[model samples]
Every structure is written in C-alpha cells, then in structure tokens.
Target: MKSVNFKKKLTRLFFVLLGVTLVYQTGRTFFLKQEWQARNCAYEMVKLLFPDAWDRACDQYGLFCFNGSEKPMQKCTGVVESGSIILIHGLDEPGLIFEPLALALHRKGYLVLFFFYPDDQRIDASSRLLFNNLSSLSLAGPVVLVGHSMGGLVARHMLVDPVIDYAGARARTKVPEISDLIMVGTPNHGAFLSRFRLFMEIREQCLLASDHRWHRLSGFIDGTGAAGIDLLPQSEFMRHLNSLPYPGDVHCHMIAGHIFPFPVNMPEQFQMTGNQTLEGLLLSEKNYFLSVLGKAGLLIGDGLVSINSSVPFNVPVTLVKGNHKTMLANCFSGSSRIPPAIPVILDILEL
Candidate 1:
C-alpha cells in the first residue's frame, strides 16, 4: 500500500510541474510577441510619414535615386544658387531625412539638390542618369556634396568619374562644382552588423513576428533578394567601390554616430561583454574591438551600423550621439521616437 501511494504522489507532482512550465513558456511567448508588435507599429508609422525618404535608398547600384524609366528626363526646373549644395541620403532612407539640414543650408544662402533612387535597381544606373542630367545642365560653381550613408558613396561616384575629368568637369558645369563632400553616418567601410547570426534573427523576428498587416505593404521588403545583398558587405563590390580613387580636388569629411549609453535589454549581439549590460558594454574597449574586428565580430555599433564601418577612409571624422535607427525615428516626437545623432550630422554640415 505504501509503495502504491508513493507512485501516485510522483505522478501528480510530474503533471503539476509540467503544467507550470507550459504556463511560463506561453506567457513568455506572448510578451515577446507584444513587444515585437509595438516596435513594428512604430516603424510602420515612420514609413508612412517618410515613404519617399525610405524608398529613395540605394538598391544594388551605387547611384543616386531614380526610377528606371527610359523616358526623356525632365530638366531640373529649380535653378542653382552660387553656393549650391547637393544632398544624398543613405540606403533605405529618404531626402526628407535631411529636411532639418536642408532648411539650415537654405538659410545660409545655399541651394540644395536632393536626389532619390530606387532601392530595387543597381546603383550605377542611377549614377549614370544623375551625371547625364548634370551634363545636360552644365551645372557649375562651388558644389558641396552632402550625403548620409550610401548617398556619400553615390557622391563619390560623381566626384570621381574618370570620364568627366574631375578638373575639366568642374570648368564646364551649369551648376556649382562639387568642392566639399560631407558624409553623415556614411558606411564607407561597410557594415559589420549584417554578419552576426543573432542580428539577422532579431531582424527576422521584428519583421516576421508581427502579423500587424504591414507585410503586404508594396515595398515592405523591396526586392527580397536585393534587400539582403545591400545589407551585407560584398568583398567584390567593396573592392570595385573602394577602388574608385577619391578625387584629390575635393575635400571629404565623415561624421560617425556613437551612442554612449545603450538600453539594458538590447540584443546579445550588441552587448560588449557576455556578462555586462548594453550600457556597461558601451563604456569599454571591448565594444570598440567588436566594432573593428572581422566581419562577424562587430558587436557594438550605432544600433544598426558599426562605428568603424561608418569611417570613410582618410576623411575627417566627427562623432555624434545616437544609433542608426535613431537618425530617422525622431525620438522627441511622440509619433517618431528615433535618436537624434545622424540628424545632428546635417546640422554640422550646414554650419
């Protein structure tokens, strides 16, 4: 009788423990789902307000934004001022991203040329088109090329095009000649954030975890294959891209974003040490190593882009406070809560 009673007790205990575990697991899953939904909702709101900005991001080519249409191009109706400045935004970002800076530059008596390119096509095509348009207009004066992220790369393509003969091109322009190149949060070196397994998983989770009905949006993923390749650093692409020599006649400067303080709950891939919180990790050399290491070793960066990754070689560097996503999110606004670092880049350039 005693033996039978013991067996019955053990069976009851097993079922009780199993029930508790299931409840905990279910609750955890539910919490994660809720968090992801909230974030997606926020990003979606940003997308709505800045569709053109996001849509104009560089696709496969290192070109300015343009529709791949064969129609005769419309001449820029907007006339250039003496000290005109051209603005280029990064991959998946829009020209509006530079609105604050654009207004500032305008106040300084500088006209701004904002270019938009499709994220679905090669960047070179857009570059050729931008060149053709400029050639037709013969824009000449002192030009300042200001770009954020991939825009900087596109600007490099323009300033260094051998066919244009850097010096001769400047002499024949109808618009201002590009004299200075300012890149804000530009990933001249390439992104390390793309190599981490955890980073990819988290991105998948953020986009795929939510059933918030945004997956059906027209450019939600924007050329599934194109999106992934653009995010990753291609050695072949990089060699070709970096091989384009920097034009000696122009001055190049880059501003990098660095968020000294980070959230505690940030992903493990961003953590500097296995034992430290994200905030703690940002305060040490370990974080820098992660940023400067091999392709997969970038553990610390501007939320989305690594620090070393943003350095355009030999350009003067400026550091700001914010993460990659923060540049576009406008954290001060309730509807847009991104950081204010890259935006600050615009301010510096305008000054």
Candidate 2:
C-alpha cells in the first residue's frame, strides 16, 4: 500500500512540474489571445498536464464540465439498470450544469454521462466530438440522449443528420444507436435574437477566424459560439440543418420553458411574476422579429428563447415555468433546477 501511494505521489508531482514547464514555454502564445480565449486554451493545456485542474478552469469559464464515466457505479444515482444517458448542455453552458436533473435521473437508475463541447466551434464539430467519444464507450443496452438549449441542436446533428455521418471514404464508423432523444429548451425553429445582421456578422468573424473561435467574441451580449450562431432565425446554417428529415430511429421529445412573457402572446394567459412582465411585452413588441403580434398576442419566451422557437415540429413538448438562464443552476451559480421540470424529465426516462 505504501509503495502504491508513493507511486501516485510521484506521478502527480511529475505532472505538476511538466505543467509548469509547458506553461512557461507557451505562456506567451496563450497570453496573446483574447481574455476568454486565453483562459480556454490554458484550461485545455492544464487539463492535459494536470488531471485535477478542472475546478480552476471551470471557475474561470463558469461552466459545469466533468465526464462521470469512471465514477463508482454504487455512487451514481438511478443505478437500477445497466444503461447510459448522455447529457449535453445548451449554448455557452457546461454539461455538468444538469447536476440536479442528472442526479434525479441517476437515483432512478441510469449511468449519466455529461458531454461537453467547445462553444467556439461549429455545431458539426461539436456533434463529431459527441459521436466519437460515444463510439469508444463499451456499454450494453440502448443509450438515451438529453440536450438542453443549444445542446439539442448538437444532438440533432449527431444522430439525425445523415450528412454529418462521422465517416470518411477511407475509414467508416458506426453511427451510434440511440434509443431516445429529449431536448429541453432547445431552439428547434431558431431564435429571434440571433437574427440581427450586425451581431451575426460580428459573430461570424469571431467564430470563423483561422486562429481561434473566441478571438473576437468579446463585448457582445451573450454572444454565441459557432453552433449558437447557427441557431439564428433564417440563417443559412439553420436552413441546412432543418432541411433534412429527423434521422435515426430514436424517439424524440421536447421541453419548453414559459416562465417569461413576450409581446405577441395573450398577456393574461402567460404566467408571469414581478414587474418585468410588462417590460418583457414592450421590448418583445418592438423586436424586429417579434414586433408583429400573432392573432393571439405573442407570448415572449423564457427570457431568451421564445415558445415558438422552443417547440419543435411534431415533437411533444412539456411546458415548464422558468426563464432560460434559470432552468439549470450552474456550478458557478447556485441556482437550482426548476422543481416543476424534474418530474417531467423523470417521466421521459420511463417512456
């Protein structure tokens, strides 16, 4: 036992020293990028050199990102059966943000894996990351995929888009067999906020740059990465993504948040709290995309995504109370998952 402990200590020390050396050598290159980009690159480097540097990295970025595959099965929630459920987070958020939901599902008995992707890159790239990692996991039984916000778009490309088949002419890979797919607060029809041409243009330059995706994204209000950019209403990326039929044999379900009121909806019908309700209507009524009220006054979305954008065609969606940012309390922020959504998600697992 002493020998094993000694070996572990030595290994940790060696990595620490190696990390310092690499940082010393590449610190200049890492420093030159934008603040967020620098932090992102540094985090990736530390992740490779030091196994336990995640907390520090996560703090700087304010996202939940940990792969729980190696955790002891006994400690996992919902251990009733032997199956896996992959959780993908929405735009600019981390996978681990689903802690509340994941734990609840785990108690019900499924091995949950939180999948994280680089927000700075394209949706296709994110999807590729998810598929590639999933291919390596040796598991038995059907796998359920749950994506929140922008994550749902990523999952769609991964399992539903035939064009994005992660196979090349030289080497073909097996498409992941998905049993069911659940999207929470996903913008299936695209969001109105991303429709602004100026913001979209600026985002394009930032995300498509050759050097790094995060280079010029500073100062934009919750500016999205490549996938987020694609979620723009009427954008070409969205058009192509939606052009294809929903692929695979996976069962699909959706969850939409309606805690906030918008301009086009019947004000009295929407459940609203606080003084911001009237403000929401005024702002949304003037929004270029949302300005025109529907025959039934337009109801604004859960702060960010409108109800129309959240609901996907032909997919059954459970409407819950809460705004976009409050749906899943993140690691950095102590906000907890909205209580009402829990049972709905749990019910999906049984389906």
Candidate 3:
C-alpha cells in the first residue's frame, strides 16, 4: 500500500515539473517575440524620421571610406599614397569592429575603406554588394582586402565566384585589383557556435535594444536567418565554398587565436597526477555535470571557432594569444590595448 502511494506521488511530481517547464518556455518565447517586434518597429521609426542621419550611421548597411580621420565619408578625402585597404566586418557587426585597425592603417598612410552589409543576409549576396561597391570606387594602386570572421568568406566568394567576373564584364568596368587578402579569426570550415545562432542573435539584439528606450524589452528573452543557416558545418554553402579554389594572384594569410594555453613543460607523471585528480573530482555525482562543460571550453577554440576551422586553405598562418574578438580588438573597454593580431597584420602588410 505504501509503495503504491509513493508511485502515485512520484507521478504527480513529474507531471507538475513538466507543466512548470512548459509554462516557463512558452512565456519566454512569447516575451522574446514581443521584444523583437518592438525593436523592428523602433528601427523603422528612426529610419523614417532621420533618413540622412540613419544612412550615415555606422549601424546602417553601406560602404564608407575613411581618410586618416575616424569619421567616415562617402568619398576618399586625401591623396592615396599607400594604396587602398578595404576592411570587411563579420556577421551581425555594426561596422565599428574595424575602428582600431582602420585607425592604425590610416596612420600608416593607407586609404582605409569599410564595407558594411546586412549580415543576416546570404553570404553571396553580401559578396556581390561588396564587389559592386568596389567597382564604383576609382582607387589608384594596389588594393588589399582584410576580412574578419564571416567577412573572410565574403572576400573568398568575391575572389572565387565566376558571377563576379560576369558582372564586371557586363558592366565594362575592370574588376578591382586585389593584391593581398588577410583573414582574421575566420571559421573557414565552420563554427560550432553557429548551431546556437538563434541564441546569439537574441543576445546581440538584446545588447542593441539596451541602448534605446526599449532596453527593458530585452529583459523578456532570436536568426534562423539565412546567413546563420549558411554558417553551419554541413550546410550546402560550406560544401560549395570549400570546392572552389582561391585566386593565386592575391596573397592570402590567416590569423588564428588560441585562448587556452596548454601546459607544455609539465612532466608526464605530473600530467597523469593532475588528470587523476581531475577524474576523481569529476566522478562525483555533483561535479559530473561540469566535465562536459570543461571539455567544451578546451575544444571550442577562442570560444567560437576551432583552430582547425580557422584555417582551410594551405596558406601562411600566425597563431596569436587571445580569443576571437580580443585577437582583433577589445570591443568593450574602449580597446585601450593594442590587439595581438594587429602587429602580425602590420608585418604582413609591411607597414
């Protein structure tokens, strides 16, 4: 009789937990959807009221040229002596990722240009836009392309796709001369985090919404966006891109980051001892859950991209000490320190 009663109570408890979970998930989804709708509405309003200002905003999707100054303008202002360097930003970036690097290159007398696009769109679409914009620019001398993350794939598409050639031929404009290409923290194979792109999109939106009056909107809770789908490891886009060969005319280089430092000098016995200790700790029922979490950090290089994924084609690569974002520049903290990859890039540019 006691056993029967216990079974009944357990079943009741399970149902109760399930009901609570379902309610919580449903509420969270509804909140996130509402927040997304509100954000879109606010964006439309600002875009309608301040058309010119909105166009010039870094957050907007467009190509901009900066001549030594931090302020970007439609046209290049000064003399082009050291040639032009176009900086292509990564997925969901608001065009500010290149600030530190752009300024550095500008100081070195390079004509710096920034290409911004709706990162949620298809990669080929963004590539075509970049190619079209470059065709419009009357740049003198060699042009170097520096791409970060997904930007690298965009650059590759521009270089590899026959469609670009067809467009240029039809337009009767010579394709822009690309002398060098530098890919920074690019997931050439694929990114593991891309599987969680919806979560990432929500996080980014929340950060953006935090700046506006709708900041509280994000307190509620996310892109099955085409670009996110393309970024998957086994996606058709990845297969197509990998099949193509990069142009031999342009010199290419990759910069990868290693956030975790593995012990190199430790004795084998010491290593074994450490592993045993870790195993003992992790074998406990309470701490067993942490094992996967710890392994994930080690496997997920620089938090987002694995080292193997960072390099696909056979090219010279420089490994730096920092995570994906930090290797380029500290987006937060005002980027006070010079990033590790900056010096390597400068060396490659011979600036």
Among the numbered candidates, top TM-score falls to: 3
Off by over 4 Å in 1: 1-75, 138-140, 161-168, 171-175, 192-231, 261-299, 332-351
lDDT of 3 by residue, 75-131 (tens): 443344447788898776545667788888878877788886766656777888787
Which ranges of candidate 2 are over 4 A from the true structure? 1-81, 166-176, 194-224, 261-299, 330-338
Q: Give the per-residue lDDT of model 2 (tens digit) for 144-242.
A: 788888788888877755665633311333443577888887887787564333444454445334223233222231223344446665555578777
Q: Model 1: how far is 343 from its true place, Å?
A: 8.7
Candidate 3 TM-score over all chains jointly: 0.67
lDDT of 1 by residue, 50-167 (tens): 6774454323212232222323223254344456566766555534466555555555556566665543223443455456556655354676777776677666766676664445
All models: lDDT?
0.52, 0.58, 0.67
Decide which is better by TM-score, 1 or 3: 3
What is the lDDT for 236 in model 2? 59
Per-residue error (Å), model 1, residue 34: 39
Q: Which RMSD values do the candidates have, in order?
A: 13.8, 15.8, 10.8
* Residue 42 in candidate 2, Cα distance off native in Å: 17
**Ranked by TM-score, top first:** 3, 2, 1
The deviation in Å at residue 298 for candidate 3 is: 7.5
